[model samples]
Target chain A: MSKNGFTRRQFVKAGLLTSAGAAVGAGVLKPTGLWAAPAKIKGPVKVGYQAIMSGTLAGYGEFHKMGATMAMEEINKAGGIAGVPLEVEFRDSTLKKPQAIKNARYFVDSWGADFLAGVDSSGQALALAPVMAQLGKPLMVTHAATEKLTEIEVFKKGIKEIFRICTPTYQDGNAAAFVAQGLPAKKWATISPKYEYGYTCWKMFKGTLGKLKPGTEFVAESWAPFGTTDFRPHINTIMDAKPDGLYSVEWAGELITMIKQAKQAGLFKQIKHIMLPVGAAMDVLEGLGSEMPDGVWISGRYFFMFPNDQRNIDWVARFRKRWNHYPAYVSETGYSAMFAYKQAVEAAGSKEAKAVIGALEGMKMGSPAGERVFRKEDHQAMYEVPWGLTASNPKYPFKVMGKQVVIPPVEFFNRPPFEGPGTHPPFKG
Target chain B: MSTKATYAIYLGIIAGLAALGLLGDRFMVYMGMRVMLLAIFALGYNLLLGRTGLLSFGHGALYACGSYSMALVNLHLTQDPLLGILAGVAMAALFSLIVGFFCVRNTEIYFAMLTLAFGMMIFSLIWNLREITGGDDGLVGISRGSVFGLPIVKDGQFYFLVLFFFGLTLWLVHRIRSSAFGLVLAGIRENHQRTSFAGIPVKRYRLAAFVVSGMFAGLAGSLGAMLQYNTDPFSAHWSHSAEPVLVSLIGGLQTFSGPLAGSVVFVVLREIIERYTQNWMLWFGIILLAIIMGLRGGVMGGLEKRLRQRAATRKGGE
Candidate 1:
C-alpha cells in the first residue's frame, strides 16, 4: 500500500478475486456442463532460487542450477503440481550479504516469487531469516549448513517460514564426533577455518567427542582465516602436539589446499587417525584427486554415492548423464528441495506460501539421499549420512569412501530449546 | 546553464526522488534508497577527484569506520538514527583527518597507494578483530529505529531518511565545489607548485578536501549499514573502495554531477542486467568497457562537451 491508500498489486489482486468469483459463480450455474469444478490450485507457482554464482565457488551455483532445472523439467512434464505449472527463477546471491538480501527482494517484490530456495553462505542464510519473516515467504535453505538458522532463528526466534532441506552443522560437527568415538585415538587436535562455521563445528566435535569418550584430550588447535592458501604452519602445530587423532572442519578449496600441504609435510603419516568433516565434498575429492591421501575419515551433508539404493544410483546416473559430471552435495539437496516444495504444494492443494509451509511441517519424502523428514520442532530436515575412510577406487578418478559409518540425525542433532544436557548437544565451551 | 536553472534542476530531482519514496512499491523504494546512498558516496568522492584533483583510495576505510562506529552505537547505546549518523560521521571525519595528515604529504600515485594501503589495513583489522566486528559474518540485526520520534522501521520510511541525507550531502558538496576554497583546490589540482607560490597552503587545502570527501563516505557508509541492516569487513576492502573511484571515472571526473549519474548507471544497470542473465558481470563489464572507451570523457563529460560544441555552432550561425 502507498500513501494514496492503494497499490497496483492490490488492484491487480482485487481484479483477480472478482474474476475468480465470477468463474466460480458460472461453474455453479453450469452443474451439468463441462466446467463443473473450479481449479483448486493457482496457476504458475513461482519459485525464486539463489546461490553463489561467481568467483572460485561459482561451480557450486552451476551444480545447483542443474539439479533444480532437472527437477523443474520433471515436475512440469508430469502435468505440473496440482494441474498448475511450476516456475523457477535462479539469481546469483554471490558471497556478499547485501547482494543476497537484494536478490531476495528481487525474487519476492520484483519477480513475484511465492517461495524462495537456495542460499550458499551461512551469513547469507542467517541474514535472510529476518527478511523472510518480513516478506512472509518460505525460504528452503539447500546448501548453507548453519546450525543457527534452525537452532537459533527458527527454533528459538520462532521464524516459522524458515526451513532447511539439507543437514546443518550437525552433519559437520556432532556427526563427526559420533564417528570419532568409535576410533581408539585418545588425544585430538584440529586445523579449522577461523569463522563462525569453523568455530561452531570444532566446538561441537570436541564437546561431543569428549562426552562420548570420557578421556579424550584436545591437544592443540590452529585457526586458519579465510583464503588461507598455506597450511604448513598449522600442520606443524598439529604434528608438534603429537595428537593421536586430528580433526579439521575446512571445506572446499581451502580444505584441498590444507590436505595437499599436509600430505607434503607428512602430517597425514604422523597422525594415524584423521577426520575431515566436509572432506567427502565432490569439489575437495575432485581437487585433491590422487594427491588426497587414503585413510582419512570424512563425511558431508550429502554424498551422491550414499545409501547405495536403487533410487540413489538411478538419480546419480541421470545427473551424470545430463551434466556429464558427478552430482555435488548441493546438487542433491537442490534437487531434493524442488521435490519437497512440489510435495508440500500438492499436499496442501494450494501454492500460497503459508499453506505450503503448513504442509511442509513434519512432511516425509523419499529423495536420492533416502528418506528425509522435516522435524516439526525446528524445520531442520532429519536424515542419516555416512562417514567413511578415503580409499582408491578404479570406478571413479578420485578416492571414494570405504568402511562407511552411518550416524542417525536424532543421535546428535541439537534438539528444540537448544539448551541444557538433554535437549542440546553437550556444550563444554 | 544559469544559476537559477541549475537550482531548479536540483530541486526537481529532489522532488522526484521524494515522490518515488512516497509512491513507489517496496522494491522500488529499496532500490531508490540504494541509489541515493551511492549518490551520496559518489557526490562526496567527486569533491576530491573532480574539484581537488586528488585520488585517495583509502576512503573505504573511513566508510567502514563510520559504519562500524554507528552500528556499535546503535547496538550498545541508543537506537536513535540521528545519533548514530553523528557518531558515524564524527568517527569518519576524525579518522580521515589523521589519514589525510599523512596522505596529503604526497600527491598523485603515491597518495593513491598510501590510501590503498590504509584501506586494506582497516579491512584486515576488521577481519581479525572478530570479537568486535563479527568477522566475515558481519554485524547483523541492525534496526532503523526512528528519526526524532518518527519511526523509520519500515524501508519506505527509511527511504525518506536516506533521501534527506542524500539531499543534504548533494547541497554541501555543491557548495564546497563552487566556493572560493573550491577554486583554490582546483588551482592545486591544476598546478600545486604555482598555487603554493601564490601564498596558499596547498597541502592544507588538499587535506581539507580529503577530510570532507572522507566525511561524505562515512555518511554514506553509516546509512548503508542501516539500510542493509548489517555491516561486514568487506565494506573496507579495496574492492569496495574501487566503487566510488569507478563511479566517478565512468560518470565524469571533471563534472559536478558526473559520479551521481555514474552511480545510477552502475547500480541500476547491473540490477537490470542481472534479471536477464546469470553472467551479468561479463555483460556489465562489456558495457562499462564501451562507455569508458567510446565516451572519451565520462558520460557527463562527453555530454557537456557536445553541448559546448553545439552552443559554439549556434553562435557561428547567428
Candidate 2:
C-alpha cells in the first residue's frame, strides 16, 4: 500500500492480472466483479399485454396501454426496478383464447419477460391463468372481472401468481344490486353478453337482490354473444317484457351499440331506470352523448368525480394533461394496480416474488379510487365502489356521474371468515 | 431421388426438430409444438387446396368441431388422450361430410364464401350455446393425459407426440399426392369440365378430399386443444380458416411440403416481429406482400425452381 492506495508498480502488476486471481490471494473483490452490471439494459420490461387490441373492443386495449405506459414512465423516471428499464411487449389476443395462449407463451419465452400483465376479457384471463401458473410467473390482470380467477381452481391450484386490479364480476353485480335497491324498481329485466362474466354478473345480481329484497323478481333475461352488432332482437325482447327496470352488464363498444339502438328504438324512455353496471366509462358515455338519459343508475370501479381526494384529483389532472381526456374507471383501475404493485414491492423491501405476494395479500393501500385492501382469503380488492346517476354535462364532453354514492368497503364486503372456496356475494342488495 | 430418400428426409427433419426441442427450454418446446400443430393443420388444408384445387374457407369450422369434440370427450368420456383424439377426428369427418356435400357443388370464391358463412354460423352457435359449449369462458380444466402409455406432461414429450402425428400426416398426404386418385384430382383442377367428360365423378372426389382434409385438421385441432387444455369459438373463426390458406400460399401451394415450410416460417416470423412491436399485423402485412410479389411460388417453390435452373445450365455447359 502506498500514498494513492497502491504504488505505481503494484497498481501496474494488479492491473496486469485478472481480478479473480488477485481476489484468491488478497481476499478482495468487488461485489459485481468485472461484470460492469450491464448498462441499464435498454428495452421495455416486455409486458406481454393481451387484450382485444383490434376489432370492436380495441378502445379498451388502447386505454389499458395508455394507463400502463403512464405508470411505466413514472416508474422509469424514479430509476426503474433495480435499474432494469421497463418496456411493454404487447400481443393482440384479438379476444380469442388460442391467440391468448399463444401470446402468453411467446411473451414468457421469446420476449424474455418474467412478469406478465394486461387482459381485458374474462374469457382470455381464465384461459391465461393456468398458463401463468404453469410458467410460475406473476401476471397482473387489470381489466378482467371474472370472480372465478381468484377462486379454488386458480388460487387453490398452486397458482398464487395471478393478481387482479379490477373488482370481481360479483362485486360489480352486487354494486348494481345495491343501486337497484335504492331505486323504486322491484321487477327487473337483465341483458348481458352471454359468457362467464355475463352469467356470473346475472347470478350475483339475482342472488344479492333475493337476499336484500325478497319480493324483487327477475321478470326476464336476455343473453347475447359478444360483439353482436344487432342488439335489436335482444332489445325488443327486453322491451316486450316491460320490467320495472333493466340490469345491463354490456360495456365498451357493445354497450355503446346497444344504447344507440335502444335509444333509437325508444326502449330507454319506457324503462323506469336503467341499471348499467359498466356504463361509467367515458368512452361509453361519450358515445352515448346526450342520449344517455337522466336518472339511470350506473356503477363502476372508478368515477372521476367520486373520490374528490388529492390522490384522485391529481391522478385525473395528470391523466388529463397527458391524454387530453378524462381517465375512465378502466384506466384508473390500471393506475391503481401499478401503485398497488409499487406499494407491495416497497412493503416487502425486496422484489422477491414470495415476499411481494405476502405483502400484497390482505395489504391495504390508498389508490386514486380511495382506500382499497386486498382480502387475504380470496385476493379480492375491497374498496369504495362508486355508483351514481348518469346525467348529460356541458362542462364535460360526455355524460358524467351525478348524485354519487361511495359504498364503503365494510358495507359492501363479506369480511372473513370469507368463504375460502366457491363464490360469495360482496354486497347486500 | 428415391422413395427411401424422401422418407429419410422426412424422418431426418422430424428427428432434428425433436432434438432441437429437447435441447431448448419449455418456451421453445411450446413454440415448437405450436408450429408442428399448425403445420399439421396447414397440411390438412393443403390436401384440398394443393391437390384437389378446392379452396374451403370453413376449415376452421372443422378444426373447431374437432376441438369441441375433444373437449366434450375429455370432460364427459375417458380422459385417455388417444381415444379423445380419435373421437375428435371422427366427429370432424362427419361434420365435413355434411358441410361438404352442399359446399362442393360450388367452386372458387363461391365455395370459399359459403364455407366462411357456414363456419361463422357454427362459431355463433357454439358461442351462443353457453350451457354446453361453456360460452366465451371456453372449456377449461382439460387434462392432456398420457400419449399411448407414457405420461405426456412435459412440453418436450408433447412436442414429440405432435411431431409423430405430423410425420404420419405428411406421409399420408405424400401417398395421396402420388396416387392414381391424385392424378384425377389434378386433371379436375386443370379442367373440371374435361375431367367430368372423362367419366370421373368430380364432385365425389372433391368431397372425399374435403372430408380427408377435415379429418386431418380435426387431428391437429385435438392436439392443440390438448396442448392449450381449452378450446373456444375463436378456433372456428374465419381468421383461423384463413391461416392455412396464408400458410399454403406463402410456402408454395404446388409443393407437397409447402404448407409445412410456410407454417414454420409464419409462426417464427410472427414470434420475432411481435417481440419488437405491438403492431405485428402491419409488419406481417408488409412482409407477406413482399413474399407474394418477390417470390411468386413461395419460399420452397422459388428455391426448387432456382436449383432446377442452375442444374440445367450446368448440364448444358458440361
Candidate 3:
C-alpha cells in the first residue's frame, strides 16, 4: 500500500482504468443520467414556456420571451433557484388547444420541465387545465385572462396545478365598473367583442355598476365579431342609442379599428364619457398612436407608468433598453411569473409539484406590477393594475394613461364557491 | 412489392406502434397517437385527392362534425368513448353527404371552392352557436372514461387505443383502395368524361369517395378529441382542412402508404423544429418547400423510385 492506502502500481493502474472507463461512460450514457439524483432540490430548474408565436398575435409571444429571458438571465446570475441552474425553452402555442396541450406534454413528459408558463389565449389556457393536472407540474399562467381558468378549473374542478400570475376578467369587467361608478354618467352603452369575453365583461360591468350606483342603465350594446375590420355599424348603433357613457371590451387591433372608426364617425364627441377596458393595451395605444383620442378612460392588466416604485421604474427602463419598446401587460406578467416560480422554488427548497404549489399558495412576491399575492382559494394572483384616463406623454410616441384609478383586487375578484349571487359573472341578466 | 411483403411491412409497422405504446415515454406515445390520427385522416383524404383526382377543401368541417358530436355525446349522453366515436362518424357522414351532394356536381377548382364555403359555414355555425357549441371557448373537460375496464386517461394507455384504430383505418383503407370501387374511382380520375361515356355515374362515385374520405377525417377528429379531451371551432377552420392535403402531398399522392409516411414526417419534423427554435414555422416552411420541390412525388414517391431503380440494377447484375 502507498501513502493513499494503495500500492503505486495499483494506484496508477486504477487511475488509468478509471479515466478510460469514465471516457467510455461519458460517450455512451445520457447526460441526464449523469446529473439526475433523487433529492428535494436537484438538477437544473427547467421551465417550458408556451405562447402565441404564429399569426397576428405572434408579437405577444416575443414580448413574453423578452420578459421571461430577462428573468432567467437575472436568476441564473443570482445563483438560480436553490443553487440549481434555471433553463427555459419557448414553444409556439399557435392559439390551438391541442397544440397547447401537445406543447405542454412535450415540456413536462418529454423535456422533463419542472414548471410551465406563458399561455396567450383564454381558450388554450382553459383547455390546458386537465392536461396540467395530469402532468403534475406547476403552470404559472402569465396571460390568458379567462376567469373560468381559476374559478371553474382550479376552484370548482380542483385542478390545483393551475396558477395565473396575471389578472383575470375582473380587471376588464368588475374593476372597470368600480372605476366607472364614480363618473356622473348613469346610462352606459357598449360596443364590445361578439363572443363570450365580450358578453361576460358587459354582464359583469352592468351587474357591478348597477350594484355600486343604483339607476345605472345599460342603455344599448353593440357586439362586433372576432375579425371585424370595420366598426362603422357598431359606432352607428352606439350613436343611435346616444348614452351618457360608452364602455367597450374591444381589445388589441380591434380596439384600434373601433376607436379610429368611432373618431371618424364623431361618436366620441357624442358620448363624452367613454371607457375602454382594454384600451390601455400597448398594442392598441401604439397602433392608434396620435390618433387615439385623449381623456378616454382606459384600463389594462398592467400599466408600466403606474406602480411608480423603483423596482417597476427600473424594470421598465431595463425592458425598454433590452427590447427597444415599452413593456406590454403580458411582459410584466411573464416576468413576474418567473420571479413567482423562483420565490416558490426557493421557499419550498424542492422542485416537486406539491411542495412548489404549497409554497405558491397565498405567497406574496414583489413584481414590476407591484406586490402580487397568489389567492389561496383559486391560485389567481391578486395584483393592482390601475384604470386610468388616456393622455399624451412627452416620453411616449403613443397615448399614455394619466389619471390612474387603482382598485383592490379582492373587491372585484370572484370569491370561492363562485356559484353564488355576488361571486358569479352575473351571467343571468 | 409482393402481397406477402406488403402485409409483412404493415404488420411490422403495427408491431412498431404497439411497441411504442408499451415502451415509449409519455411524449413519444402522445406524438405516436397524433401521427396515427393524421395518417388515418390523410389515408381517407388521399382516396379523393390521389385515387379520384378531386380536391375538396371542406374536410375540416366534417372533422369538426366528428369532434363536436363526440364531445357532445360525452357531455350530454353517455361517457362511452366507443359510442361517442360512432356518433362522430355518423355525424361526419351525414354532414359530408349533404356537402358532397353539392360539391360532386362540380369538378376541380369549383369543387374545392364549394367545399371551402361549406367548411367556413360550419366554422361560423360553431363560432356563433355559443350555447350548443360553446363558441370560441368550445367544450372543455371531456372525460376519457374506461374502455372495457382499461383506463385510457393516461397517454401511454390511450396510445394503444389510437394504435388499434390506426390499424383498423389502414386495413379498411387498403381494402377500399383495392376494391372494384377503387378501380372505378381511378378510371374516373384518369378520364371522368370517358368514364361517364362508359355509362358510369361519375357524380355518384365522386360523392361516395367524398363521404368515405369525410368519414375517415371524422374518425381522426374523434380520436383526436379523445386524446386531448377538448374540441374547439378551430377544427372546422379552412386551415385545418389543409393539413390532410399537405400530409398527402408530403407522403406521395399516388402511393397507398404515402399518407402514412407523410403523417410521420410532417408531425415529427414540425415537433423537432419547434423544440429547437421559436422560428419553427419559418424553418418548417423551408424544410417543407425543400421536400416538396426536391421530391415531386413526396417522401414515399422518392423512396419508391429509388427502390425500383435498385431492383432494376440488381436484375441487370443477375
Question: How does each model score on TM-score?
Answer: 0.93, 0.89, 0.93
Candidate of highest lDDT: 3
- Strongest candidate by DockQ: 3
Steric clash pairs (candidate 3): A2-A6
For DockQ, candidate 1 versus 2, the one ahead is 2
B65: Cα error in model 2, Å: 1.6
Residues B89-159 of candidate 2 have per-residue lDDT tens digits of 99999999999998999999999888888888889888878888887787887787786689887677777
RMSD of 3: 6.5
Least accurate stretch of 10 residues (summed lDDT) in model 1 chain A? A29-38
C-alpha lDDT of residue B214 in model 1? 91
Under CAPRI classification, how is model 2 graded? medium
lDDT against the true structure, each candidate: 0.89, 0.80, 0.90
Arrange candidates by TM-score, descending.
1, 3, 2
TM-score attained by model 2: 0.89
**Worst-scoring 10-residue span by lDDT in model 1 chain B:** B134-143
Proportion of native contacts kept per candidate: 0.51, 0.71, 0.80
Instruction: Write one digit per residue (lDDT tens) for candidate 3, span B24-100.
Output: 88888888999999999999999999999999899999999999999999999999999999999999999999999
Span of 10 residues, lowest total lDDT, candidate 3 chain B: B152-161
Candidate 1: residue B196 lDDT (0-100): 98
Mind giving the per-residue lDDT tens digits that candidate 1 earns over A195-257?
Answer: 888888998888888888898999999999888998899999899999999999998999998
| Candidate 1 clashing pairs, residues 3+ apart or interchain | none
lDDT of 1: 0.89
Model 2 whole-model lDDT (C-alpha atoms): 0.80
| Model 2 lDDT tens row, A1-429 | 546688887878877764656565456543354634454334444455666687767787788777877877887799765555556556787777767888888777766765677787777887887787777666777778886677744456647778877776755777677777777888898888877787788887888777777899899989887668999999999999998899989887888889889888998789878888888877888787887778877877678886888888898899999998788777877666666766776676655557777888889988878888887766777777678888767797677888887666565554444464323444434
